[model samples]
Target: MRLKYYIIAIMALALTACSDFLEPDSISTFDTNYVFSNVDDARKGVNAIYVQFGVDGFRSRLSNNMTGNTDIERQSGWTSSGDRYQIWDLNALSSNGDLRQFWNAAYTAIRDANIAIEGIEASAALNSSDVLISKTMYHLLGEAYTLRAYWYSMLTYHFGDVPNVRLAPKAGNDFFLGKEDRNVILSQVIEDMMSIEEKMLWAEELPYGIEQVNREFTLGLIARIALQRGGYYLTPALNMERTSDYQTYYQIAKEYTEKLINLKDRPLPEDFRQVFLNNAKFVTPVNDDILFEVPFAIGNGDVGWNIGVTVQGGATASHNYGSGNNYMAIPPSYYYSFDTLDTRRDVTCAYYIVNTDFQEEFVNGGISNISQGKWSRYYLDAGPGASSAKGTGINWPMLRYADVLLMHAEAENELNGPTAAALESMARVRRRAFDSALWDEKVDNYLASISTSKEDFFDAIVNERAWEFGGEMIRKYELIRWGIYSEKMAETVQTLKDMADSAFEGTGPYADLPDYIYWKRNESGRFTVLNPNRKIAAAPDDTWTRESWLLGLRNEVTIYQEWITKDWRNYIDQGPKPGVARYIFPIPEEAVTNSQGVLANDGYGF
Candidate 1:
């Protein structure tokens, strides 16, 4: 049952030396009969697949880059050069270092999964003498297939059509097969998952619970995959295509999401913040709504330490796990975009208070001071500055009930316009983000204001998703599928430009703050707000100078001034045009060259 401990050594049994790097070699000499001979070893084989979740490029790097550079989150100005910057700048090349890491990690996982599936299936055949395969054996095989499907899902999502390896590759095997179409890979993956849905254990039944993949996670993934395939994707041919029958995929997504939603005791959590705070506090999810998560341990991999306070700057050793590198941040415009009433805004953003550490004072160092707090170390069990660098023991949820509700609303609206069922689902998630006492009336009023048209309702879903899953890494993929990644980023650029020019005077959140003034904490220990009218104040000392003190400790200015002066504009279009190639990443250069003409780096040749 303690499978995590065994993940470290599981890969040793399957690897072998080979000439072609792309041609994965699983040692034919290793005895599959022994590895999957019993339930315990079979479980370990599955454990190996989960181990890859904690690997560098697989979870940390991918999640960081995918979620880090949208309109909501921006790359820090400090780390200006690197693969992370390439991803944020939307100009990722085939040679980007982390892109190569992501490529190698995903295919390696796929190769391991193929080996596990072959080993488990062969072991099951050898046990045919038994009247039926043991329940443990069935679950083991079910998990193996699900894991394989999950890895393939990642491959298709990022790299478009990739080599589909369903079987273990031995010494003389041709692992250098040409890439398969994405739809082709997704079909195989969907079929493989559907076949095992009934045999796997549900989240409610698992002894280890959310630490491992459960039936709900499998079902959620089915919906996610179907919805993705059902939606538009950029292909290597440099054209967008609905690779699958979209209506069928949408229906599949709808059915699975609704089924997951109506499960006997599962429902949306009463509060939105608890979804993450629970993970930060317990490091293990006990919430009913969390269907599946990637588990972490004290020493296994650097999953938690690499996110949150470690990267979000402004973290002092006093308030977080050591000092932050200021590597990732949210733009001031993004921070201002939120409605002041939404509880999620505060939890997601950390507004900069004035700093007077040196002879001169500053306001959030201008725009560079804003950062995210969703994964802050302040929420971890060890609290800020947990003595070790290994990683905080926090399990990251891959799927949540709120997402199902949102997806359900989206698909239902697409299928039959705006129905009461779809509207209600959207309301439920929105209501949770506000004050509970006022939510009922406020949410109803807000819903009534939205046009009943399908397009209007769909736009509501788009905005809600950005607010709901801001730092969770779901937004980038959503924008790409909606076919507006380029337009949205362009719009955000203009919006920031306007805000910067006006010194944020009339902006909803930043309106009342002065263009420049002093700030200091009051008796209640909260920072006092400066008057917007101070520019022409009767008091002569109320001037917009760095030396002026107006009832506070340090001079302050609206964040917009900083946005215009900083290098914020460069985040949007640092490379080529926003075309089909921009939506999908280029296959790593090493991967293509090493494949010896078997692999084509078509759309990503740049």
Candidate 2:
């Protein structure tokens, strides 16, 4: 029951391709009456909504490449002028191709979901006397609602107040529409998901399990979007603001997350690395750590191609694990921020890559180029081919159970000031991060120290999320909702500067940190490093190879690399509004032109 195979089989028959942002090509020729007459075709109609995820818009760009310059994940886009680099630099123009692709894909998916919802609601199969037929139709209806809501959630945040298209395309329907208020769009989707989530089936009950949108994912998404609605966002005037009744949304977030915890809770996986390794190995089990993932079929995803540890391979290479490069690198400051005893540190950051000779070697770039160590094509059980690069068939995780626990903790702390319920939820997530022998100090004592005040607990949650989900590309949205997007980026710039200064002058905050690291392969033929956390005078023996660590932050004539100094310059101080990141980008020029007189590029100096 692999969902991707079904989706691929039905895409051409059920989905309509869009000619522009909102105009679907030959949609009027689609026969919805026959498609939604039964459970089988209705399921195919719903599966079409997921086709957008496999395209260039999401497969390579939106998932990982476009979500950089955050506090944890980074890429110095100052030296490049490509479409993705422009986005990473936080100055994307109206003609940016990446934005155009994602914008069109989102609207196209929304249109497909709209068709499914309309057709499924009108079908008589929903009220059929056969219980299995009736129940299955209801689940398909819920999937339509949840999938449409997911696209809207991403749209409103990326491009504020996008056109809200809720109806299926028709010959006489009004295609030209104005931008709807984002708050209104979010509220509508939140209500839409809430009304249908309970009627949906759980993952285990569904044929595709976690590959399809189930009740657990819907419930978790309600909480996730409620937090986004209650949290801060940039306005057209370029000021961060939240609704006056923000606590109501927080309450919604709290209740929905608690409902999932009480009804369908599963223990977090004891091993942190296995959560992502499961994705690489194509081992998807329902009701486990991951709630839902985009099920990309063979030769259709960009997981290892653009977002994992670099693997150098080609026709001349010995191994067949094809070349892959991480567009988003882990920041050195983020690597240093982790506790030495924490098990997640080594799994989240890697300084070595698979060389062309099929051997592990240090990355050529300095400290700034450390690859995200979560998933790589090298981790695949079998390589695609020697010259393969683009598609690894790996699924992209959308939500996890750890996020639900943290969301519950955050909401309860905000409303009730770190009560016992809040403390317990936080502790549950922390316990799995450490061994039982060390839980007394790492979990128990750590919770006690952060529970003194509400604000303290919130800060702890922020830091805990950074450590727990470092390599994942969701930090940009989290920082934006917390109203610290620019603040954190500025802090990262200063931290890098301080590390560079300390390495050169030999007396500062990071002076005790290592200026050089020594490494050698162990008996198991694995790369091993010494003095990764502290300074050392010399290697233990000549068997070790030494490389400059923090000292690489500076070069011959400059205090730091030019790209490092200019990494987040506009996002910090030179954006549309100084000291504020203009998170909203303009709608693509083609979209605006196609809107007739209904849309305009008007706010944040667009």
Candidate 3:
């Protein structure tokens, strides 16, 4: 039987609208006056908030490749001519549809929660049925609030200054304060969510893992937001500019997340692949470790069929059993980093693939042979019996219980710098990945990955995030929060190339670097276009800023231009240069056109 499921991405906050002046307030159309007469309406509203999870996951997954977040350097090839889909520019994104959907959905969710809040305040005591429904109200409302906070935090990280909206703005609501300070926005988000934290239970719903928000999720979210606000507004790695609010967030993160970690069910399962493959033994299931996760369903909405990079006999309607790469290729060094015994290396990327071109065996390229491999299954259809319309049932984890364990470990290490407990926590993940029996004895030996000094320990945690959580949204956050993404990209990409070149010195696989000629471009003005070549000794450490001279040849430049700007400083509270607007996602083109710009929060542009 085919099970149709949907992963509700409720916990989204909007693009902090760039400014308050971008849109005008709508009067008399929608009001909190007659908001909720029943519970289902409120539940649906809560569902809307969850939609942000979808937005976050899809955007994170696609961009992980194109964003230089991962070592998958062939992203430009995936977007080139004759390809299935072309990424024209950085701002023009594969996940834009989700962005558009998310903006509308999040606001609608806010409007619904606003209605519930208004109703709760206005009504009297309820019967038993009403009591359960009331608790649901607070739970969902709290979730909505948390999602709002999460979304806003994400915006502030990506863009910079975003318009902040608290209560739903009706004709009579306070519209005077349109553009609040980023800290002020963070404050409102935290306050609204924290208000309901005490009222909800910290339990995970069944089937879904720990990353799903519960009371524990509230605490974790608090920790995440607090840490981010601390880094961005104050206590930034370089101490660029410190917000008076830094201490507040730092303490909040310490307290709430510590409570979560100290819970009897704290710590993650030692296995690495099970976090993604086995939903039953989920880290959250083992204890309160799983804080929050987005839901996934097949043949549903935007996140439905044929959406990922898996090709050929892949689960999509257009498959002829010969199209698609089966799974996206990975860089060779990525696999080399894995110990032969480490389950994650195989679980994360496929080393090789098999195909028969003329009833004869043909081995073209595999993930290990390439740069980075796609980890998910690429069944052309479901059960090997159904058509492309039905795909293998696999749910991708946007956030997992393991991630929470790491987050707790990271937050703890950040505060104290170096502590055995923190180091032990980090090693627990790696030990399980390699050998569980040796966990207690051999785990202590991993200091080589990071080092022993306090400062070095902190650096180890950052590297741990990269080495352990590579390709996930966490890497970028780790780098930026640690104040090192620009440097790390330049360093790692180059390291990869040099490392590859060194390893393939005598190996036939990389002589003349047949896999790398196309990376080079000739911008010798006389011919301003690329002259294709594939003779690579190793993958080059090419990135956006590094490819300034060959902007047309690289996708890094394509994507970088979409988001990074001379305006990043403007979004910073006290930043000198202009910063990207951080708060709310720009109201999508349809949104402005639909409402004549009267309903948008502000600070949005194409």
Most accurate candidate by lDDT: 2
- Per-residue lDDT over 424-457 for candidate 2, one digit per residue giving the tens place of the 0 to 100 score: 9989888888888999999999999999999999
Error of 3 at 229 (Å): 1.0
How does candidate 1 score on lDDT?
0.64
Residue 58 CA displacement from its true place in model 1, Å: 2.2
* Model 1 ranges with Cα > 4 A deviation: 1-21, 76-79, 125-133, 300-304, 310-320, 352-366, 383-390, 504-575, 578-581
Candidate 2 overall lDDT versus native = 0.88
TM-score result, candidate 2:
0.98
**lDDT per residue as tens, model 1, 482-517:** 776656666666666554444433454333433444
- Model 2 scores worst on lDDT over the 10 consecutive residues at 5-14
TM-score of each: 0.84, 0.98, 0.67
Give RMSD to native, each candidate.
5.4, 1.3, 10.5
In angstroms, give how far residue 555 of model 2 lies from its true place: 2.2
Off by over 4 Å in 2: 5-7, 11-14, 28-30
Query: Candidate 3 — which residues are off by over 4 angstroms?
Result: 1-41, 51-74, 77-134, 173-178, 204-212, 233-247, 264-267, 279-290, 301-311, 314-330, 353-381, 384-394, 440-442, 447-451, 504-606
Q: Assess candidate 1 and give its TM-score to the true structure.
A: 0.84
Count of clashing pairs, candidate 3: 64
